[model samples]
Target: MSIVSLSSGEPTCTTEDVKAIAGANGFTITPGSVDETAFLLFANAFDATCEAIENLPEYEDPRLKPVIVDGERQCHRPDAVENPLNAWAHKTTLTIPSAKGPLAGRTIAVKDNVSVAGLPLGLGCSPGLLKDGKHPISPIDAIVVQRILAAGGTIKGTATCENLSMFAVSYTSHSGVVHNAWQPGYATGGSSSGCAALVSIGDVEEARQSGKDTRDYPLGEGVDLAVGGDQGGSIRLPAAYSGIYGLKPTHGLIPYTGIAALNPLIDHTGPMTRTVEDAALMLGVMAGYDGIDPRMTPESPMPDKVPDYARDLQAWIAGKEKAGEWTADGAAKGLRIGILKEAFDVIGLDPAVADVVKAAAERFRSLGADVNEISIPLHKHGAAIWTIAARPMMPHFVAGNPPDLLSHTMPHLQPNKIGQDYFDTLAHRNPAAVNILMNAAHLQLKYGPALARKAHMHVWELRDAYDKALEECDVLLTPCNNTVAPKHPASTAKTEDNPDGCSERIMDLFEPAIGNTLNTCSFNVTGHPAMSMPVGWGKVKEGDGRLPIGMQVVAKRWDEASILKVAKSWEVGGRWTDSR
Candidate 1:
């Protein structure tokens, strides 16, 4: 007689486990005391369990067989044999052409964390999974992947992401450091490291001069679009660092149906691209109620119309679109931008960064838009609120669940089924993952999860403060990051005594990174739309050539049109790209 297992649990249960199980139940079972009689009794019980299992009705498979897309896999890990900046995880070069879609001929790179049916998705941190010689490839295309193909975008490959997508910097990936596309040595704020690098690259002159593939697709240009996930500024941070346009849309505007998320509540998936028009195009095609992702309810907050993002942006920039339905020429002329004073007042914010941002704000004011300095006292607590609100749920992500939309588990971080090396890497110090997890554990142990509950209440206060400010203004403005991209962090070799210290060295990034996230993370909790638009280029270093500086725009929930309108105005005013 065989016992029918209730569910697949721990793969193994040794005799030590049995004793422990008995101990947990307030009983003592000596190692060999139960003897043959107990074994016979257990066998008898298993017979009944098996009989019940056989009598139980069987459940049919719930999932429909997906319409398979024709494609082949071509793995491209440049760190293995080529340049580190070559950030393609797998380049399928697969073209499922659409006859009349808006994104036709655009080149898109899906971040590696997203499923691309047959491409490898490492989540950026696991080394052991790949070393096992059996790569667990995605069998079904993620929802966004399907959207891109349907919209006629040609996928180049899966873009590189930071290791386990834990850090904001590009250096921690197990594959290798993801270098800045603008200035190679400086960091590309991540975990959308590859998405930004690919979008920022301008070596197209060399590619054109070198006479490469320039026919149907053309050469000497960066990617037209890329999809990136944001838990705490992953999409916007890298976009700021690499000098590109990135949007972290309202928490649920885009379906996170098939994405790897850090925390369910704060998780977002958005588009990063070279221009505001392109970003809008990508968003227009991707957002809607997917019938999965519970975040999409009957009352799902969406634009009055869909798929008109780029057209609207074009009209708005040309001074043709209206503010709403009420007035024409109001898209730009009537915009009210609220600049958060505390964002610039961050205690350790770089002075140069502050000055540059202030100048940009003045530019907005001078341009005849209604821009004013507004105060949100609790703005300083954005990062802290995000910390308490997001990190406590990380343990669920650490357990690794996909929390698939079809599975109907929104607002929950599902376990990633892959055998992650999280435990193996635990002995190793990771500036981002280890520190965050350890800190979360300490908080729960010392203060209990009740603190997390209280933090939710505090989140309301933060949101209310921002909402009150937004009521006075259409959007809030701030610097995306305080300084230009910092130099790449130096690596430390694992040593006998300092083995773990090597992982902790990312702590060095805190000084430059801390203030950078203040303005961005709050929106994650507030669930508002935010964007980073490259405004100007400034010296990230003393003598190094100027790199991109991005200004962040935060709008009221579901007001993506206003954000794009302002961004398009800036672009059409001749600040689309640096005059390099």
Candidate 2:
């Protein structure tokens, strides 16, 4: 099967264009080719994308290719638009007031789960027929979104969020999967998938040949910034899979004012970008207090007008350069990084991914900060507390009484069509599905103090253990997934039987007891800032090409600045420079 060329902006790619770009970029996108080496090299050169194809190499192996439809030599490709709305509207801008003078040139993508008045707040679900004729309006902007706009950052549009922001992959109850722009064939890791996708895809090419504004840069300006919410691994997963920098900041570090709630104790809104410094500038703008969010911590609001985090980041880079820790060109000389050996191995990850992550760890060690192998025992129970606390609330939010769903209506009421349809299918399969779901709702009625007690105990233990581990290191590193981007399933639609399977796989990868909660959930639960940065490319079975690998860096709570400093150091080290 051949790919359609996207170089012409005829709304989709054409076979001939795909072939031409593939050849020029040193790879092939044909089905059944298993072109791993070519794919990795191609992915490495994505930033310099051909007249129209930057980053296509990120997922360029044979495994990355989708199975050919009908096994025929087709000349034309599908012209379907993945998330066509009533109208695309003009891609506009929203300015955020910032203490850093002004974020004049920066651009950002806000997750639909984070409310910005007027735009549909579909958290990817259908609200059903509304009794009230009035549409939902966000009384105020979600603190994070407001902060970004205030900083002079221009808003593109709301990026799609997963079903009620429940799942890890980004498809919502409204939009289906947001394909990874880095590697067209793999999953973009959800809930925050759209933000990562738009940022990675950057802007449309002027024409295919000039190659001046390669597909990698967003609108040909400053770094692309993305703001998203994570109750589980939403932000981290997509950022990692997309080979970008994504941070799940300490819980409550930023106000959640208009954002939807998943697990209040764990829910957090954060930033994603191609670089850590960009992430920092976003955080600096968005972090602070607003009385509207009862969850906001009283930390003096960190100054309503904070200086440009970019300047601080630049200074840090300069210091590293002067100290010979890193070259001015972005290669680190010496840095200390620790591998969560136990955490990385528990997921039954692909050997190639494991190898690449290990190689990255070794590279940091060679550059000279202390390197250590360590384990966080409490990580074992992470998934349990997560499910016990999170699952019971599913029915309530997914299909409970009207108010419960409406409470989080703005920005993310129902984000994905697949997710909503999935729920509808479950309801149709067994008329009792709705009743069963309602019974499982997260109301304290059933979960009360008894369940809360159990959850609290486990959480306390885990938090205590996490704090101890952080005391021993500046940051902890681990793989984003057990394998590279999992093959994008033939479709995101889920039958009742398959509903929990995908979510389960993600949970288990991050934590067994809690299942699929490995690398990300722990951070969300612990309320610490964790950043997922793409490091290298690797192969996976069924992934004909190389998939990007993400290194998860976790820091102590509210110490986002430190995490950014370290991540910037890594970024300047040339790890992602070649990630293209």
Candidate 3:
């Protein structure tokens, strides 16, 4: 392409403008003929460069074109009756582009932040916070969405996420609170709340169809699988609480090109499914280098080279069976399992929940695996290091100006200039969003960049610590959440008597999620592959019935196969609910 010609208009800079610009940066321009003339010339060149850039055509990747039909774009905001759990952001069905791939006949839900052409990308924020009270309609498909269509998966709709995907609980989504699939009015851990609920509910329906007793499950319809984003436990937390499988794949294993990102360092998108086999099938199609996102590295397999995980898993089981090694009493004979000692010691951990996870971990011994407790002292500090290193860069991301790191940037999805209106709307729905903005700014002002730099260095150390631990064991096990899903708190909407929109204090809205991601977030920072597997059942703190308890399975970086194998062995042994 030929370069666009620069504008011939007169320079817009003035000596006064130059002085004002320099003054803002704690500097002054000398007011003399020679200095003034030189400064004006320099400023004009900069302006010309910017104008020339604007004149160039916007770049769009030819590989990621959307395939929307004329009438396929029609979508509606489902009513409460249509969406009992309030998990859907919009409901529509897109055409399946293929019919012979591995995911043939499967239904999939995409998270709200992922771009699906011609659909409203709500990002789970209130309409008032969006431009003109409307969410942006995506113009192109995300890389994952493209892969799903090619694999014969029908696009069901966009699933709701937490506000700005900042909270770990489901009640913060602007669509309305998402109730647990197992029990209404209780929490479904988020910000991948909708994906979790949909897949879990789908499992219940499937169980009923197979003549399995589902008298305890609520009535609902859901998709077979879902694509979920994870920054810090968003995907896994919900999976644990809802009795499903959610994987946070090793960083860059799946391209994040068309998804809304919080920070490039920790952003990941993976499968949320009701079965380990389904998770493997979805990952097989999704894992590969797209040549667009900077997050993918040399470690990422090319599209054609991606392993058929579902096939490989079955082959592994078959081989074990042929050798008479996959017996009922020794399904995991060759596996080495480690219980992360510090994961059970986090503050606010429920005694019953801990006991449930402990019992689940010990069950591995019955399968002939070597199960033992392993200690990684630095594990306890991983969350703090992750917070400091990543928080300083988040405000820039929230404002839609992420660092220009040569990735496929999504400028159209960036929000309008943030102001009081944005803050007020976000604070009422989810104070966590506002808190991130303020905390990032405060850290920047007080510590400058040194603190973040130091914390980032510690991130490497933390990774090394976990690496050392994994050297002694194939997989490390930890309780996914400190407790079973809690009851949903009241909304923060402003009321006549409570003008501030808070129950008693501003912190009340966030209190329920304290330390929720203690075990999961560390693996996110370390870039280790982790999966939340439903292990048993634990009682809710405030309720009488039981909720699913999940145990996190962590493997070395890019070793999702190990996670799948370990989870599958336990899965084949029997029902997790029976273990309780």
Candidate 4:
């Protein structure tokens, strides 16, 4: 092939831009004008590079069958907040009309991080930070979104997510601090804040017609289900605090395509619902391989194969009833449950919280299951190793452009500018993001990539340890958080001197995360399916009245069905939840 100079339809590189960019990669450029020979050399390299880039495989869209057309922006409100519970990120109301399916007539709210084609995706970041506006209407729908719409569900709106989906507390959302549905002053336990709140209360207009504010600490009787993504316990945390059932399904079961991924390896999307059955029903629709997501494979569970995971729960309930083994006091015979001592004994766990969770565990024993303490010493170190590994590596994926559009990891990671507006607002609105970014930067600079690489090795060991422990028991139990719905640092009235209680001394980012991360984050990194179900209520020293306490149940890989059965069994038995 001829080394053609100034080839037709080739990418043109400006001299100054080329020099600046090439300098970063250790290339030196002289200020003098280049001769024809040098220009030809540049052209030769450019043409070859273009050929290589063009030759790379393009993403193949799953092209799912639909009532709604693909790539159509069906709902949105640009440059404005939609409503209070929906958050400031973007306001939208959409229902991609579909014929009757399993989830027919069900209303759902999806987290902002998940894409709905033609709807603005704020990703819980400020409008100005994104190039076009606060809510950038997504060009394509995420796999879960398509699945839900196809299953005859109604999408209420795009719910608010924490800024960059980084914080556990709802107050850090880009639109604004989200109000706790249970108590006005308490944290909603985010980044799935809007979904939890809105799903529980029902539609804003309809709830008002029913003479309820919808935001007035209503239970999830109105809306059917909500969807949430978990990179580091986002789904489980919000559901726990909001007193609903939330599951972080085993990673790779649901295609993550079209979601704004914080970490490819850790991301999972699942159902948050008022009832365990609704959660299982939603899971039956959402779980499966979509060809688009690079992470999904043939072995992952498919909804069709396990048709009616929702209905199967009743069969188990019926069997227990037939045996006369099921009583109003207890249900589910011959089940074995293990309570993790490490999660209980973790740093600074509230005694009251521990008591409530323990009572729930003991109920399983009353229900005829052998309940015992299973020790996995490595679990104690999960959070620490997660910090060393997951925390430090997240900024690379979130702040920088990923190598692929679908969820993927950048092997040769390099830090990129996260944009100025993000930091400027995040400093005050989400100090947690500031802390995380700064911590990641510090760790990377201090130990280099070798430290993160070594930390991944520890993560694998932790997963193996958890798997071995599961062999002895069907499920592992833990308190979801040390405190149930702690008063929001920004909004709660604690001292009486300050009604809002958002004073500078009290505005601590790590406080909300203190007890929450110890138990939940371990499952996130290990790709294990874990759930947080509202089991009992307890009063906190920091607040008045009894608050909801969630018990986490983690099952072995692809064993979500087992855990769901257990959760439903305990729920129907009526001893554990009613004891509060």
Candidate 5:
């Protein structure tokens, strides 16, 4: 259709244009404007690859049109073989065979926590702390990583993760804070921050605006891409905040062998990308039986194996697909939706956000989904799920049997490897010292789960309510976060920014933070599949301040087929573009 030509000859907005807009608006664009410019160009390139520009007519402004047009521009040859991030900044690169058949021309950025042979899988931790300073790179690849490679998807590079992929914010020993593509002053959200960063910045839309070379982008737009892992919303959070589609499949549906693990209770390896179709394709590549992970269920099977995710995408896009073709429309369409009153009332949501949630529920009703406000009494105690899961598991992370107590107490658990002399001091400490230490560990192990179980039950009650609601309707819809993205840590100006700043305190301060796990963790804990699809941006004044927001959809366990179907339906209806 020569869509680019059809657009009133208006130049798509690029990073430069955004800068102008920000400057004109009196918003002081952050100091790293150069990197910001480069990132916008990269984001555009990837947007062009997937025909995402065709969807941007709504962006309207002529100058902005050039951003998408320019973002899609490609390099004559691939830059897959070398480290792309090795240039002026701490960029990275990797190589894998291209995606097979329909995805043959596509490229991917793998999560560093997932092993790729001949490359170090540091999981963003220092090399010295690792088992031999190397991931047990399987003689056979991590099932999903190998699958993508087999599908002919090229590996761009390993994305960054929090140490052991524990935290969501992506600060690795190897890579410092990865800047957000939309606004440098903001965060891109992590442990999968690298995937989002590279994908967002790698596109031509972002690159051209920044005036960087097109071929050198980090986040590629067009190709069938995949992301790895989800535990306490690692993949989904980045996907939602960055504006992309992320699927955390039913646990054990996709094999987890060859990937690094923090705690098995919630760890899930999956794909994150720009479209549902690409997510499907990546899922196809990654799914299958691998003897390495006992978690792989022999009974579980990939949903209708296909050679390419693109084949099914056509029917979906045309609206020719049947109503029951996937999960019934997750929107209000005859769906039974539960408004977890506990989830709504308890979480410390931003004031602007509460209004958004209230409004979204109304919108679902407008769409035809049956809405019910239900109360899950346990929702108030939901934060405990993390403690219950991490306490027992944290000890395994200690280097040896008689572990170092200091390691556990560090802010954010950033590992500080101690020599024997330092180790002995703690080991041989007096009874009072030992008593205090033992008491503390006992609290974490004992109290953590109590808190987690309380939270789990509350979430479980919500799930039960959702199931009942689903029995009456189809899907549950909820606001993705309580507040819009918080101010960047750098802006906070704390060199030793307390992880707790973002973790426990602020999370409780906002409604969405605590309740997000309410809707999200149920899917994880129950082994059901769930996805968060972008509906639109929240209110401009305080709700994300123009940042995008998503609506969450959850389906019965192992019913990702339905979740994707309905989620995509809502997406097309809304013209949701996977921005990162």
Candidate 6:
């Protein structure tokens, strides 16, 4: 029995076409052979099916439907004068005027890679990569954007991200370099660079005004909070470098629908804020299954069943106050803290940073928490496992063919095809992005899928290792960045001496980010919730000033509550900067 019937109207496939296809796949077709005839029929059926499907009306998720506003979507690109840090990709005001919820009166900045209907989503790449050299306007809001509006949060604009959201330093964004909130001509960390800058700039200004010993930097307007995306320390790195709080919640805890993804296995979007409470408040609204992102597993909570993180934290504090347990000396009472030994032992770790983070971790003991060092030997190899497991998927993802997990996909954002323009632009703007594409291809050609499969299997073992270690402690601690933010690398500009503007040597471009994510990326693959909270300050590697140092707090999967409680306790004990 024939699965697809031959019809007079079926598209005809020639013998040459069959031969070309076979030859592309390292095979040859014989004329008039049975195999050639079978290939012809298969080609015709494929063409017919593709045409039929293309003709069918496209399906859009009702949940992702754009929310109508009374007026046009007001937005504009800020000039360098108006945007000194180059933090904002586009500035706009978006909110439901009549809506009221936990985020009422809060102004938020969304990372540019996430969707914001009617605004151009740059993805931090050069304009050449986009269709017609212009960024695509998102037709629907991302899940996090929708939740922010529903919670009465007013979105101020889209923050800039690194090119293709690939780099850790701030200079790679196509728009321009995102300067640190504390200093100009220095990095803010990345790929969520702009989010960290927007959230921290206001606090930095306030500190300067209060007679604090800090350098003066002209910063434009900043938002109250920001929604930052993370894959291998994007959220936490920027937050740490910018002196803010960035949380990468457990995988599947928050829906990732309508957001641009590097790989579904590691994509996450969460809150970047100045205070722990704000992160908790934002998480309460954004964390829940949307029934659209396939990343949401059975472990994900239902919408109505999600925890009231803000309220619960307040209640916990209130209980402590009533019982005379809210004193600074006892805030962390009964909590257990473990400093991951390998995290501090990584190469390039600054002694100043290690001292700051270690001192901060020990402060929990003074607040009545039991703190100790625990060793996880596998932690040293976590980044390798994470890279191997996720690298093989990048080439396919960049080609707009992500894994078919039955999840809702944004076809408009997917590129039609990658060509020379993409490679040339990406190479000049961010050599790291080009390296990823080439590395994935090389790995596939050399070791095959088995290498990725083995890496994926090791992901489970890595998760188990963390889980076992976490059982002995409430939260694990580490230094988020090995040192304070480094200065931005020279921009790739066309010049007489440097004609192409980009360095031919990959090391010239890749050296700054060598160990940036060493301490933070492991938990991303393990699916453990981790946060970067500013704990102190450290001297910049090449500059004559200080930059913020953040300590990472990690908790077992789905146990964000513990992480929050621990952070809040440390925050209440005293100001982080005082540790300096």
**Number of the top-ranking candidate, with TM-score as the measure:** 6
Q: Root-mean-square deviation of each candidate, in angstroms?
A: 6.4, 21.8, 3.0, 5.4, 22.4, 2.0
Q: Report the C-alpha lDDT of model 5 over 1-580, residue by residue, as the tens digit.
A: 5434333433355766657756875775564678676545544554464465545432221211111111222222124333232111112233333334444657777777765544455565445554454343222245565566555566555666654554444332233444444444445555576666555553335446666423333433332365757776777766665666777877777877556555455668887877777777777767665544655565666435422335555555444445532222443364456665665664555566656556655555555566777664544544454445444544444333322221111111223343453233222111121233354468665675465456556555645654664564455555555544444443222236543222222322222223444445545554656676555554433234355565666666655666665565555335543322
Q: How many residue pairs collide in each prediction?
A: 9, 70, 0, 3, 71, 0
- Ranked candidates, highest TM-score first: 6, 3, 4, 1, 2, 5
- Candidate closest to the true structure, highest lDDT: 6
Candidate 2 local accuracy as lDDT?
0.58
lDDT of 4 by residue, 1-580 (tens): 5455434454465566556666766766665557434654675567666877778864435462223633344564433223534342444445545447888788787888877766677777766655544455555667788888878887766777887788787766655666655565567787888777765553333436676333443233236688898877898888877778899998888878777777776778899988888889998899887656776666685656744678887788788888886774557567879999888988878898889888888888777787889999999989877787777667766665673444432212223357676666567667677777788878867887888888899989999999999999999999887777776665433347743233354357557766577888888878889998988777755756555678999999888988897897786557233565
Q: What is the lDDT of residue 506 in candidate 1?
A: 46
**TM values, all candidates:** 0.81, 0.70, 0.93, 0.84, 0.64, 0.96
Candidate 4 similarity to native, TM-score: 0.84
Write one digit per residue (lDDT tens) for candidate 3, span 136-176.
88888999998888887888899999988899988777767
- What residue runs in model 2 are displaced by over 4 Å at the alpha carbon? 1-91, 95-101, 129-139, 170-173, 203-223, 305-308, 328-335, 393-449, 491-516, 577-580
Candidate 6, superposed: residue stretches over 4 Å from native:
1-12, 213-215, 492-505
* 1-580 per-residue lDDT for model 1 (tens digits): 2343432333244456556656776886666666533543454455555666777864322231122444554555544344546466666665665334777888898887887666776677654534343445655566777778777778788887876677787766665567776666677788888888887775333334466424222212347789998888889999988878889988778877666667777888899988788889998988876656766556454534454778877766555433342222232466787888889887666677667666766665544578888999998888888999778877666655444444433212233333335545532334567667787888878998888898899999998999899999988889887788887655433357654224454456444456667778889988989999887767866455567788899988878988887776555345635333
C-alpha-based local distance difference test score of model 3: 0.86
Q: Per-residue alpha-carbon lDDT of model 2 for 402-438, expressed as tens digits?
A: 2331122332233223245445543322222233345
- Deviation of model 3 at 466, angstroms: 1.1
**Of candidates 4 and 3, the better by lDDT:** 3
Candidate 5: count of backbone clashes, pairs at least 3 residues apart or interchain? 71
State in Å the error of residue 374, model 2.
1.4
lDDT (C-alpha) at residue 56 in model 2: 41
Model 4: lDDT to the true structure? 0.72
